[model samples]
Target: MATPEDTPSQSDSTLSGCIRPFLTKSGLTVRCQSRVRSQCPSCAELYRGDWAAIARSGVFDGPVQNFRFYLLTLTAPSFGRVHRVPKAEGAKVSRCGCGARHSVTDANLRGVPLDEASYDYAGLVAWNRDSGLLWDRTRRRLRDYWPSVEFFVVREWQDRGALHLHTLVRIARAEAPRPALLGESARTANAFSKVDGAFVSWGEQGDCQAFRADGDGAKAIWYLSKALNYVLKDAVRASGGGARSWGHLARLSTAARMVRCSPGCVPRDCPSHTHTRYGARGHVVSASRRTKNRTGWSFTGMTRKRQRELRSEWVTAQAARAESAPAEWAVGVLEARAGRAGRELRSRVDVLP
Candidate 1:
């Protein structure tokens, strides 16, 4: 019964430029600037580049000997037992809790719960919801121990859809703790959620490694690039997995929908996408902000605002240069004027004869 007008257009011929673009008040075409790789890869790459520059400034902009940098990783407590499957090639993995040795190619079962009925789906969702608060408490504890600490943290999604944190921590050399001690302090830090008053803590798996900005420049740069890529890469690929993986995600989604995100939230009526995204809500990447008494995350005090201002200045300068140069249309205007003048002269002479 659908006519051509009723049917939606499928052709991409009308689309051009950015996948998501909008007009500013001044009629400038501006992209939506999504940081999610799945939404708009070009904008996401730009987002990663901007953050990478800021992260690099924190490491390389100051005297390298004055500061000590550590890469720290923290994970969420296990909600339940999952398959012990490895994705890397030739990685040694023992028998899973379900009494089977999963191979590297068993991708679909990698994060699937050993027993779906017994898996703590609600607990997993709650932890993801309160993860930001947990990190805040952990960072505060670190600052209490060493007041000179500044950090850049990225939240990444595990194969099981849980959120884990990777932090680039900086401290004055005089106050820096041993890398092992730093990791232990962070791993043991705990918090109580404000929403539902749930106890939150990190997993036992924590690690920290110290690196020097002044060390072999090539290796340092390579490591930095890899870290940035790890942070910016898509958290979850939208692939069609086998039954076990699909069912595991479905249970998580259902748990997310049923849980209360806030004190007054109605689970069924709330419009927040936290329920849809496996209860993950908040900024995935964050850095310490400059304060009156602190150097903050970036030693150079670089920020996204500074980047925007620089781009605006460049655009203005380009416009000025364009206006100063003679345009191609100006030549045509001069030629038309000369032709009109000659015709006028000829007409006057003919009248005189």
Candidate 2:
């Protein structure tokens, strides 16, 4: 039954005074007390507690499980021309922009997609190639726009083979900002702009469109997960050589190489590698590697359900650890001080104990 009047505003000295002792006892140290950000020491303590709990759980006692595997595809715009070898005998050909008749030997005669018209397509491919950089840039821009908002960027290619980015962001209750305002700031930051505006608009195309999934954790994850599927479908189609209009082979080849490379190599020592440690703990867990034909790579180990369960357990453990800490000691001290002050006020007002 805490009302607005009963709650302390973020700027209030009384709230800081009440919270400081508990924070200190909890081993939370803030470099900039004015900023009110989650201190690293606090995060480390929570992470360690979660890790200890998970290690005790024995959920992953069995052999590793292989989770779902997906194929991603995308139709990329043709960037360059090549010698056109006619499959049919005596096939009629047209002259190229270079004034050479389209033929096997005449590389200049090869027709390529118009550069300006295909600028967006090119940009999209480049975006896919450097989606990690784009995500880092976007997150940094968002931080500048709103100092309290924090996020982690995860980049993946969709089945259709288009590059997709998934960002897991956390905004403190006191630090939440308007999504619309952040979106405006994002656009202004040149997140999807180009030297020429036409291609810029093309590359910026995504089902998620604007950055509207702010503050709402479930909504944001859903949007990102859906977008991941969309790009994966496109990537798969492009990889399968089905999108001939976009000159599928080259695009497919590039995507195939990327898939094989596994762009962000999740090291075995990285906390993300441990499926159970996600969100609550920090333990480096390497992605399961599946080698195909001595060249290709795919992830293996841990079903999605198990991963979810493990993550839930870890989070619960962290909350328990936070709650079990000596918060009551700080509370007891504050209550004693408040009780003495109340007694003094009552004595002055001629009240009996």
Find the candidate with the highest lDDT and give its number: 1
- Provide the RMSD of all predictions against the true structure, rounded to 1 decimal: 13.5, 24.6
> Candidate 1: misplaced stretches above 4 Å?
1-17, 24-28, 235-237, 326-353
Q: What TM-score would each prediction reach against the true structure?
A: 0.84, 0.31
lDDT of 2 at 105: 44
lDDT of 1 by residue, 1-353 (tens): 22322222221111122478777799666667778777887678778888998989888998879988888999988888999888888888898998888887788997888888988999999899998889999999999999999998888888788999888899999999999999999999999988889899999888898887886667667657656776566655354468888889888889999988888999899998778878878877889999999999998899988987776676556444434543533454466669999999988995785
Model 2, TM vs. native: 0.31
Q: Model 2 shows how many backbone clashes? A: 38
- Residue 34 of model 1: what lDDT? 77
Displacement of residue 67 (Cα, Å) in model 1 is: 0.7
Note the Cα lDDT for every prediction shown.
0.81, 0.35
lDDT of 2 by residue, 46-95 (tens): 33333322321211222212111111111223334433434345788755
Model 2: how far residue 21 lies from native, Å: 52
